[model samples]
Target: MTATTIPTKTIYAGTGRRKASIARVRLIPGSGKLTINGLPGESYLQYSPNYIRITYGPLHTLGLDKEYDILVNAQGGGLTGQADAIRLGVARALCNVNPEHRGALKAEGHLTRDSRVKERRKYGLRKARKAPQFSKR
Candidate 1:
């Protein structure tokens, strides 16, 4: 009788938020590839180089850009917010893979969550801060 065993790859998870967007990211061992909400990352991001670069910033900073496949579930907000969220998520996931990477990621600002969001409109204002035109009679 012969016995065989299968190798299993570990999956690392992290969550990130920016503005109103939230992203859940997973890191799996493989050639570099990114998928968001079941769609190819490039197509989902509208093929924008800036967005692509933003999402991969952490990996590049650590020189691990081609070490893993990234799967993300992102929702809410615009593309920019989602991209930032993904960047943070990836950085956090890398930290899980190896905590030593934290300092590098933090230094690169990839671990910071942007706190800016839309301001609420005041009851007497036309917009968030716009006031009615002055009437000099």
Candidate 2:
């Protein structure tokens, strides 16, 4: 008997981190729609460009100027941070889904992991950047 082969599906997985927040994502090709546990997107839609666009920036990349419907579960971030984290997670997943899209997303710096974070204040410093009230004698 001849050997039969089945095509493998491309799947992408990525994690998003910002400050103390993080979003884990698994992406598959489908009608874009975002569903976040208790909070329905209807209320959060205004917060995010789109379910999948959160990370892909689908509108910017595809240039369709529209958002896709997708399901998402995010935690650890505020409305804005969660949105950003979701975007990161989704974008990373997109890279795994298709290698070709990497260039497009990377060009926009979406794929790059955001390393910037709040700096720790040093001893005798009121803040990370601000020196304790300087008083000249």
Which candidate gets the maximum lDDT versus the true structure? 1
**Candidate topping TM-score:** 1
RMSD of each: 5.6, 6.2
Alpha-carbon TM-score of each model against the true structure: 0.92, 0.67
Model 2, position 20: C-alpha lDDT score: 60
- Candidate 1 clashes: the total is 0
Question: How many pairs of residues collide in each model?
Answer: 0, 9
What is the C-alpha lDDT profile of model 2 across 53-120, one tens digit per residue? 55447336745233343346777746666667767776666665556777888888777766777789
Model 1 misplaced stretches (Cα beyond 4 Å): 1-7
Per-residue lDDT of candidate 1, residues 1-137 (tens digit): 11122378778888889999999999888899999999999999999999999999999999998999999999999999999999999998999889899999999899998999989999988999999998999
After superposing candidate 2 on the true structure, give the runs of residues whose Cα lies further than 4 Å from its correct spot: 1-11, 45-60, 63-69
